[model samples]
Target: MNIAVIGLGLIGGSLIRALAARGHRVLGFDADPAVRATARDAAARMPATGRWQVTATIRDVAADADLVVLAVPLPALHNVLDALVASGFHGLITDVTSVKGQVRDAVATRLTGAANPVAGFVGGHPMAGREASGFASGDAALFTGCAWVLCLDEGVGLDDWLTVAELITELGARVVPATTEEHDRAVAAISHVPHLMASALAANAAEDLLALTLAAGSFRDGTRVAATRPELVAAMCGGNAEAVKLALAHVIQRLDGAMQALEERDPVKAVRAWAAEGHATRGAWPPDPGRPEEVPAHVETLLRLGRAGGWVTTVAPDRRTVTGFLPVSNA
Candidate 1:
């Protein structure tokens, strides 16, 4: 397979290595010359069997490619898509943007007006990354055993979705199908909010040198994500603003409860119970039972419902049905 990856940063560079390792011809592109040089150096170090090259421009990368993976940040995605459309390179397109809705909208708007729209564009977010950035930090193993969320909408063809899924699986990641809205909301709660909390903790502690010196494993673990690239963090949390706002509101409400509980007659019991709930919730996360051959039919149905302004919950392990609660607006 001929794969082209734009942006050549951590995710893009990693994809180049991973796809090349799988015997796919990978051409990488980055706006920054330094990044391109770094990727070229990295490619040179890889085994001779892996076909990898760094391209000078997006058009060069897109030319005759079977798949084009956009590993650029959210802010740059639409512009890149516009460039691709202008260049008249039509092929399957996928992205590693953390937020999906915006990207999907951009693709739809751009391609709808293009002289020749690309073969397809699928919004994807790999549930994998690090506090690091740039091509120098690229690692083929970064996505191994991670959940790669694929956002499907009316515009996506089933075959294109499957092709992207197969590529993700080849890179050792599970392909979890989701709607753009669902993907944004879920990540806001699980990923974006956590990063915000981590940044908050780190900023608060930084004011006190004594507190910083006293910080241990818990603080270190809690604030690790605070070190992530500011531009990347801004693109993610900002791109999914509404969802992140809602998630942050819920987080604030929970914190308010904890704060109020501390003033109760029996503070220890109140705080302990609150803490226990989180502990239990974390402990109950289902273990990844290796990737399924096909995402369950019910899961796809849930994604469809999610697109129509509803919440879907998977029923207990009967593994056959999903329940959706529609929003009042939809109802």
Candidate 2:
């Protein structure tokens, strides 16, 4: 596959490494020269060989690519697509934007033409990231075993979906299909709201400078993602406002309950219950469940299988499920 990846940050850089490993001809484009240099070197280290090139111009990168991935931030997705459409580029396009509902709308509205249609666009988000940014922190295995979402819009053919899924799967991710609205709502609960909460918690704690100075591993670990690119997080939160607002309502209720318990001098019990709930939830959840859990369709499958097999799975602290695969029988 001749692949063009824009952005060249952690997500884009990691994609380059993954594709290169499968011997795909990958061309990378980024605004930052240093990132391009690093990606070029990273491509060399892969087991497979491909024509790895870097260019400042999007047209040059998209010129020969059969598949184009706009791995830039959510806000940039539309702009990139617009430019590609203007450049008369011909290829199937997808993006790794966190918020899909808005992105899908943007593409549908902005990139309208006989040349550019919604059918050529597949909205995507990889539910895997690092607290760090930039190409330097990109690891070859960053997306390995992670959930890569494929949001199919109307007119996107079965063959296009399969092509996109194959590209992502070859990069070591499991593919799951999602509607734009469904993806936003679910991720708002699991990913977006958590980042907002982490930042809020860490910020509030910082007011107590002396106390925060003694912050332990727990605090640091809890707030690790609070250090992610603020602009990107903002885009995610803002893009999916309705879903995030609903998710935050649940968050607020939980926080108020916890606070009320603390005010009643039962802080220890409150804390214990919170921690235990996480433990119990994770324990009840299935173990080693695959990426389809990211989608609601497979969620019921998991629940049905769980109820039938005494498995309980959760998405809260990270995906986990506990269940028994039906025993093999000799025929």
Best by lDDT: 1
Candidate 1 runs further than 4 Å off: 286-331
- For every candidate in turn, the CA RMSD to the true structure comes to 6.5, 7.2
Question: How does each model score on TM-score?
Answer: 0.86, 0.79
Per-residue lDDT over 1-331 for candidate 1, one digit per residue giving the tens place of the 0 to 100 score? 8889999888887888889998988899999998888888888888898859998988888998988898888877878987888777878889998998888888778775446767888889887777677788888888886777777776677667666766786787756668788899999999999999999999998789999999999999999999887787898899899999999999999999999889999999999988887776676554324222222435466476545434322222343443334433211
lDDT of 1: 0.78
lDDT of 2 by residue, 1-331 (tens): 8888999888988787677767888889987777777777766665555446788788889888888888888766766767777767767888888988887778767665675643478888887877677887777699886777777555665457656766776676755565677778889998999899889879989779897989999888878889877987898899899999999999898878778767766789877776675677556654445333332223444334323322222222222322223212221
What TM-score quantifies how close candidate 2 is to the native fold?
A: 0.79
Best by TM-score: 1
Error of 1 at 113 (Å): 4.2
Q: In order, what lDDT does every prediction score?
A: 0.78, 0.72
True-structure Cα RMSD, model 2: 7.2
Worst lDDT run of 10 residues, candidate 2, spans 322-331
